[model samples]
Target: MVDLQEQAWAALLYVVLMLVQQWIHWIPGDLG
Candidate 1:
């Protein structure tokens, strides 16, 4: 049970980090 929750949280964190990375790459393009 707890293990499942931990995996879910890890997946969520990974997705959020990916989105943040996308934004970081995207913003430079918009400004430049």
Candidate 2:
């Protein structure tokens, strides 16, 4: 259903944000 799709999208967004944060942390002096 639409609800499931929405949930999946939200989860994906969360994962992407986490990855970006991790990448920023890996780089020195990024200060993200």
Report the number of the highest-TM-score candidate.
2
Per-residue alpha-carbon lDDT of model 1 for 1-32, expressed as tens digits?
59999999999999999999898888866576
Judged by lDDT against the true structure, how good is candidate 1?
0.91
- Stretch of 10 with least lDDT, candidate 2: 23-32
Cα error, candidate 2, residue 1 (Å) = 4.5
> How close is each model in CA RMSD to the real structure?
2.5, 2.2
Which residue segments of model 1 deviate by more than 4 Å?
Answer: 29-32
User: The CA-based lDDT of model 2 is what?
Assistant: 0.91
TM-score of 2: 0.78
Would you list the C-alpha lDDT of every candidate in the order shown?
A: 0.91, 0.91
Distance from true location, Cα of 29 in model 2, Å: 1.7
Backbone clashes, candidate 1: 0
